[model samples]
Target: MTLTRRTLLLGLGAVTLSACADTAPVSSLATTGLPADLRPTPNAAYDAWVASFRSRAEGQGISQSTLNAAFRGTGYLPGVVRRDRNQTEFTRTLEDYLAITASDERISKGRAAFDRHRSTLNAVEARYGVPANIVTAIWGLESFYGERRGDVPVISATSTLAFDGRRGAFFERQLVEALRILQSGDVTPANMTGSWAGAMGHTQFIPTSYQTFAVDFTGDGRRDIWSDDPSDSLASTAAYLSRNGWQSGQSWGREAEDGALQPQPGGPRFAVTRNFRVIKTYNNSDSYAIGVGHLADRIAGGGPLRGSFPPDQFGLTKDDRIELQRRLTARGFDTGGADGVIGNNTRAAITAYQTNEGLAATGDPSPELLRRLGG
Candidate 1:
C-alpha cells in the first residue's frame, strides 16, 4: 500500500490507502468509471455499524445535519472491503518503479501539464518555497496530473472502510475527519469524491493531511482540491513540502556516479539531498522520492539517468527485454506496446507464443526464449 500524504505527516507507517459519497438521491454517485464492486451493495452488518457509528461521529462534533446528508444513499462498498483485505507488502525495484512512474507518457504529460499551468505552479512556488517542477512531478504521480482524481464519494468510501474494520480505528478517524470537512462546508458530501481509501484531490491528500495542508489558493474561500482547476490542489502539495522543511532552489538529489545509496543492487545509485528526504515525508519510499526527482528533472527538460541498471534475474537486459517484446508483438502476440516492462500482458504474450510453439509456458523471459522468438 502506498502511503498518503496524511500518513507521512502523521508519522504513521506506510500503506496504500486511496478515496468518497452522499445523498439527496446522493447526487447520483459517479458509477460510470467505478468498478462494479465499488458500487453500493447491501450489507446488514454494515448498516447496523453505520447506525451505531452515527452517535460516535456526533460525539466527535459531527452535526446531525451533516450525518443525515452524508449517509444519504451511502452503503457498503464490497470493493473497498476487498481492497482493504487484499493489500500486499510488495516492493518494486527502483528501475521498474521509475519505468512506471516516470514513463515516457507520464513525462510527456507532466511537461504539458506544467506548461499549461505554469503561472499557477509558479505562484505556488512563490508562496510555498518549493520548486514548481517538484510539485508538478508529485501531481503527475499522485493523480496523473488530475486525469484520475478519483470519483468515488468520500463519505461512502470512508464509512465503508471504517465499518469493514480491518483498520477500523484508523478508518473511523478518517471518517470522522471527512464528516468534519463536510460539516465545515469545504465540500458537499455529494461532491466529496476520491480514491476508494479516501485519498482525495489532485495530489491524493488524505482527510487529515487536507485539514493540515490544504489552502484556498484561488481565495474563493474553499480549498477545492477536487476542482478541475487544480490550483488549490497544486498549492496544497507545495504547502505540504514547505511546511515539512523543503529547501527551495535545492535539487531533490541526483544519480551520483559514486553514490552509496543503491536501493536495488546493481541498479543506478542516487546521492539524495535534504530535499530528497523532504520528498519522502510525502511518501516514504526511496523509489517514490527518486521517481519524483527524476521525473521532475525530465519535465524540466533534463535527460534520463546517466547510470544503467544491471540485468534481471533472467539474465535479460532492458534491451533484451525490449527486443523480446518487439519480436513477440511483430509475430502477432501483442506485448502491450513494447515498453520493456514485463507486465501481465507481456507475460501473457510470452505464454501464448510458447504454447503455440509447443514449448513450456513459463511466461518468464530468457535469452534462450528471445533467440527462439527470432530476436
Candidate 2:
C-alpha cells in the first residue's frame, strides 16, 4: 500500500507490515561555501552509482546545481536497507487492528483535534467533500496528529534504497522524484525529511504522490505538510480522498447489526460497496478502510459495531486477505478488487485459479496458497 503511497502510515508499533515505521530525521545540509562537484559519496562503489546516476539525471533535465544540492553528503543508509529487507508480515484480527489504530486514546485525541480544527475542517470539506471526522481520524492514525512525521532524510532514504538494488529501479525512480522535489524549492534538503521509503510530511505522501496530489490549501505559495501547522497536510489529505472518489455525506461502511457471517444466499461472502472501494484507495486493506470508518464514526459520537467478526476464522488478518487478493490478481484471477473482504468474486477467483494451477479447488484463500503464489 505504501508503494502506492498508502503504506506510508505503517509502523506505528503494531501496524508496521500493515503500513509506516517510526524513524529519525535527517541532519541539515546547509553548509556555506559548499561546492557541489566536491561532494563525495561514502562508498567507492556507491560513488560510482552516483556518478552513473548523474548523467541519467542530467538527461532528465535536472540541472547539475540542483543535483549537487540534493546529493551533497548523500550516502547509503544501511538501516534503511536493513529495514526494507527485513519487513515482517504478521496477522491480526479486525478487532485487534482496531484496538491499536482506533484505540480509545486515539479516538479521544481525534475528537479533541477535530474540535480544535472545526472551522478549517468545515472549509476543507466544502471545497474537497471529505468530512471532518474522517479527516481527523486519518490525522490521528497517520502521525498522532503530526507528533511523528518521520525523521529519515528523504534523499538518504531514497538513495540508500536505490543503491541497495532489491527494488533498485523503483527506488531509483523515487530518488529521482525526490531530487525533483528538492529542485522545485518546496523545502530545503535540511527540511526534506521522511520515512526510509521517502514518504514525507504529515500525511506521509511519497514524492510522486505529493507531486500529483498535494495542495497549498493555506495559499502560502507552498504545499507545506511538514510544519508545526497541519492545515496544508489536512487539506491535502482531504484532497486525496476526494479526488479518489470520496462521496460526501456517505459513510465508509457500517457493521452488520447481527454480526452474521452467512453468505449472500448461496455462498459465504460480503460484497463491499462503492464507498468501501474508495476507502481502499487509501490503504488497500479491508481492515484499514474499516478501521478508518469505525474510528471516524466513533469520533463523530457514533457507537461501536453492532456486530463482531470471528477473529480466528480464516486465520488471516485484513492485511493477509489483501495479500491473497493481490496474489490472485497477479496470477490473472480477478477478484473484482483487492480490498481484503472476500466475496463471491474472490471465492470463485480462488477456486478457478486453484483448479487451473492443479491445486485443490477448495475456494479457500490461505497462507499456504499465498506462499505457493509467491507474494
Candidate 3:
C-alpha cells in the first residue's frame, strides 16, 4: 500500500465510527446492519461533541447556522478514522511505489492535462514564480489531475476524526478551521467534499492549508479549488512552494546513470533547491521527493536515463536479474527467493554454480554463467 491521501481518509472514517459506537450506552442509536463494530452513538454524545466544536467555531467567527448545516446528522465515518490509524504501516518500498504511481500512463495523462491547462498554469507560474511542471506534478500525484478528488464530506470526516480521540487535538483544530472556511463563504458544505481525512480540492489541502495558501487566481469571488478550473489549485500550490522558499530557477535533483555519479561524502550528490525541501513537508520521504522531482523533470522534456547504471554484479538488466533468479531457482540453486533485487543469497547461489561447473568462483553472474545454468 502506498498510503496515498485517499487511503488515509478512508482509514480515518472507519476507526472514528468504531470508537464512537463502542463507547456509547445501550440505548444508543441501533446500528443493526452496519459493519458490526461501527455504529452511530446516542444523540447525546454526538450532540455534546458538536456543541463543543460549535463553541470553538463560533469563537473563530463562524455563525451557528454554519455549524448546524455542516455537522447536523453527520455520523462518525468509520472508514476515514481507520485510514488515519493505519497510515504508518501501509507504505510500499520507495522504488516499487513510485514506479506504480508515476507510471508512463500517469505521465502521458499529465502531459495532456498540462497542455490543456497551459495558459492558466503558465499564468500561475509567472505570478508565483514557480514552474508549471512542478505544479502539474503535484496535481497529478495528489488526485490524478483532479479526476479523483474523493467523495467524503470534509466537515463530517474531520469532525469524526476529532471525536474519535486518536489524534483528537489535531483533528479538532482542522474541524474548527473547516467551519471557518464554510462561514467565510469560500465553499458550501455540499461543495466541500474531499478525502476522509479532510484534505480537499485538486491538491488535497487540509482546511488550514487552504486558509494559508489558497488563491483566487480567476478572481471569481471564491477560492474555488474544487472547480474544474485548475487555476486556483495551481496557483495555490505555487504559493505554497513560494512562501516556503522555492528557488526561482533551479532544478530539483536529476537521475544519474548508476555509478556515473555518487553522493557527496556527507549529502546527496543531486542538486535539490529549497523548494525540494518544501515538497518533503507534504510527505516526508526522500524517495517520494525524488520521484516527484524526477517526474517534474521529465514533464519539462528531459530525456530518460541520462547515463548508464553500472552493470549489476549479476551482469544483467534489472529485468534480466529477476529472470536469472527465477532460472537459478528452477535449477534447484535456491538463489534465495526471487525478488529481482540482487542480494547476498543470489550471489552465493551463483558462486556455488560456478564451483560445480569448474569455472571461476567470482560470484558474479555473467552471460557465460547464465548459459552454463541453461538460463
**Clash count, candidate 2:** 9
> Which ranges in model 1 have alpha carbons more than 4 Å from their true place?
1-27
TM-score winner between candidates 1 and 2: 1
Candidates ranked by TM-score:
1, 2, 3
What TM-score does candidate 2 reach?
0.71
Give the TM-scores of the predictions, in the order they appear. 0.93, 0.71, 0.71
- CA lDDT, candidate 2, residue 284: 77
lDDT by residue for model 3 over 1-375, one digit each (tens)?
223223233322211222222233322322243443244444456457866766666887878677666654456666565666767654444434445456677788888998999999899989988889988888888889999776566766777788878878877877887887878788877567676678888888877788888889999888889888878888988998888778878766565333222322222235555666767766655666766776776677765444333444445655676678888888878886665555679889888777877878888876666666674
User: Local distance difference test, per candidate?
Assistant: 0.81, 0.70, 0.67
lDDT (10s digit) by residue, model 2, range 1-375: 644555443442100100011222212343222222212224566666777887898899788877767665555555566677778765655655776788777888888888888999899989998888888888887788778787666776776667768878876777787778778877777678776677778777877778888899989888888788889888988998888888887877566534343222322223345667777787777777777877998999998655444433677755687788888888899988766666679999999998998988999877777788895
Predicted candidate 1, C-alpha RMSD: 3.7
Off by over 4 Å in 2: 1-3, 7-41, 258-272, 309-375
The whole-model C-alpha lDDT of candidate 1 against the native structure comes to 0.81
